[model samples]
Target: MPEFTRRDIARGVALLGTMATLGDGSPLFAEALDAKTKAALALVNPELLSIARKEAAWRNGPPLTKNYLNIRKQIDGSVAPPLPDIPFAKHSIPVGKGIPDVIIYVINAGGTKRPAILHTHGGGFVLGSARSEIRPKQEMAKALDCTIVTVDYALAPEATYRVSVEQNYAALKWLYDHAATLGVDRKRIAVMGESAGGGHAALLAIVARDRGEVPVMFQCLIYPMLDDRTGSTRMPPPGIGVIGWDVPANVFGWRSFLGQQPGTATVPVTAVPARTKSLAGLPPAFIGVGSIDLFVDEDITYAKRLIDDAVATELHIVPGAFHGFDGAGADTSIAKQFTHAKMNALRRAFGEQSV
Candidate 1:
């Protein structure tokens, strides 16, 4: 078997690449005497910390942006250790008149027809594909014992804002219409997304609710990038948390998604989910965000509002974590913690005991 790596060591190409550049100001700035934790972690897996430092410096330069974008594409194309015997189907679902068609990664879960999760991949809505989301969706299938449909939604810069949301809504409607065919319990269907995907999940819930179309059972917003218009939180992120994500990278991601300009207040909820004022009557939600993410404050506030509105809402604040920390790698304690939390949330939602 291939050696398992640390969570932070995997899937953190972009995140750690950016962190190592801060030099003396870096949160993980290394010291000579640090032992035990570092040594133990290093013993389990080696070269990650050093590799991250090199990768981080390169990430700050212009060439790094090109390399980073290229890496981002690779990430989309690769989902860990491709699935077998899972029996899946893929189909194109029409979204809008001008928007690119949405694709769904369909996996058949043999059992009594049950709930399904419409997963959206993160990458600031500019990168990441259904393929990139395969692993997590597969995990969800094994855990939730339900069909998991992942959307190959439109990306920005090429597709631009609103197009993705429009496509996601169309995909949800398509899924609802064909629920019986897919052996899915339409009423138990939930929308779960990570980062940009999470933002889309929130948007999908509202859009569906507003259109009086399909009912969204739950919204799992994991480290969501809500509003492209809003960057640099009004309430400052605590200084001591994970610094893998800094303001510059967050700004870069938003700009990449917006396609026009980064800080334009003109951006709509179709682009930035947080821009939508009426989040009431969406659905029960499980909101998970890291303390270091740019969207932490917004996500936390959104969760509180959902609760205040009497929606059954669960918010988890992962300590010393950055945005998109879920895919860090399976080798770290944090990764296991995230997995357990994810499994528990899905289990509870699906009426199963924690696995």
Candidate 2:
């Protein structure tokens, strides 16, 4: 039920009837489905979307803002290097025969086989690298003084969907099989990813659980790209012309990664975690997404579903912000609120809530 009033339904029928992807998806989807989710949503909410355009005005500041706000490159300068007077060793492990480009950054967290975080970076599964996550992972290492193995998995338009997910599974499997060598506890290992990587984390968590090998302590999914359907009313509202990410890019990302247009008959949950049914006996979870973000509704709905399935789940929806808001470097109060909330969520799940 979409809270759709009769008036909304009439309006939606008019809007969706004439909906077009011309003002939408490209470069990725050559195929079109006769779906108009955006139209239906507008009718249901009857609210206008206001995107702050003036924020992009030429600042003449440093070429890049120093706030460490690139979600792919978001980092704080005060972040110290790999925890307590201990030295961390870096290594490359096998993740699908050198396909995922998996790399590891390790440091002594100064405790018995400590809890570890298998961190994955997000770039719509096309643009981020393990290097981009270093600053945050370093900051996290300092915060909890725990072992973290940052993954550099393959991207889309090249490797596509399922490849990244399979790589994620491989990395986790290796960690579980050799937890002692990695200096982490197998039972306490958790999966963490942002955006597309977050989707990958969620999907891989399901994969690992189904395989019945490694047990995940928790999953930190930050504004994860979970859904596979492209044209549903779940897209960014039309009036909000925020670039960087939108319907076109989403379709392209899916086509490139899945090797087919999204919403196709063969699309799999391994490629889109939102399509999955079974959500039980996996792990405690922390999920966060901004209200206007493309994934907001899906994220909130997924959180509710997890709770419905008797899973321990904590979800926060940061209103007044859109997708990747925390990394956008906007001075809006909402961005900071979400950033702090996200950090707090990570801290709580990692057993470092005091920080």
Candidate 3:
């Protein structure tokens, strides 16, 4: 079997469609799919289906192994989008002895006390960088007129859960301590991220709550990869996780990040957000996911758990969509609506009038 490169997976995910073809270009489960599964596939949004058909078939790459280091290097070395025209500054803050300083980018900072966001970038906890997301963060900062701080947290396998979490917490603590200087209203700061970054954001909120130091006003989780058991011990319905970030990828990402097999009993509750028992006293949250995405069930369950614990939570489920649909199909109406809902949620959380 040919080993899959990170670029190959990235290209497949960029298409954001169903895995309708196998590695050898054969039909995917054409003869074996149950009626219920066919019905689910038919319900996929027409716009997304059109895009899905235009790409080469997606294959479940081999489990990430020794070659994962190569994958990480490829992702880190990928070309980043040009910096936005908006003004921003970068800083490297000391995390601890013998650890690299956490780098952060500040945008729309300074003036009077204004709402703020501490953003984390997603790469399944193993890949990605804050620099890659600068363009979108700059646009968000401009649109919302709030200070945005994006962190370059350490990735997993190389750093592990504890290191990354503490690094993020350090960034949060730095933002809170310097809010006045940055013209940010410390009390109105929110935490936000997409995919694994969303998981980190959720973890940061919980850590903030437990540490009794920094206060997080809101958490925005975009299709967060929260539960390690989603593709391991607990499986999704037939039509889910068949495209974009699928079962094999999920298992690899989780295993790499946790430094152990996913769905095991020994995983720490603090490391995986879904495993955390209490949601009380955590900030209000906005959780959004596509109905067919691998994480839909886990995200929804987390939202329900939060509401059950008396936390104010808003859960938005998009129909006929897959993971990363918003980015892959940005021009589609569904993606537009999803983005609008997210911005509106942030506006509400920041005490600004909705657009």
- In terms of TM-score, the best-performing candidate is 3
TM-score of 1: 0.81
Model 2 ranges with Cα > 4 A deviation: 1-88, 96-101, 107-110, 232-244, 330-336, 350-355
| Tens digits of per-residue lDDT for model 1, 201-262 | 88888888889989888888888777654444443434411234445555666666666656
Models 1 onward score TM values of 0.81, 0.72, 0.86
The digit string of per-residue lDDT tens for model 3 on 248-312 reads 76887788789889999998888899999899999999999998888999999999999999999
Per-prediction CA RMSD (Å) = 6.2, 11.5, 4.9
Residue runs of model 3 more than 4 Å from their true location after superposition: 1-41, 54-56, 60-80
In model 2, the worst 10-residue window by lDDT is 12-21
Tens digits of per-residue lDDT, candidate 2, 1-355, equal 0122233212211101111112221111213212342332232211122222212111111222121122222222212243445455566777655465556655453467778888777766655666545655766666666777777777666687656776777778877787877667777888888777788888878888888888888898988877867443345555231322446556655676788778777886666777787787778888987555567667887888889888899898765454554554334466566667766766676666644
Task: Please report the TM-score between candidate 3 and the true structure.
Answer: 0.86
Residue pairs clashing in model 3 are none
Per-model C-alpha lDDT, please? 0.65, 0.59, 0.79
The candidate maximizing lDDT is 3
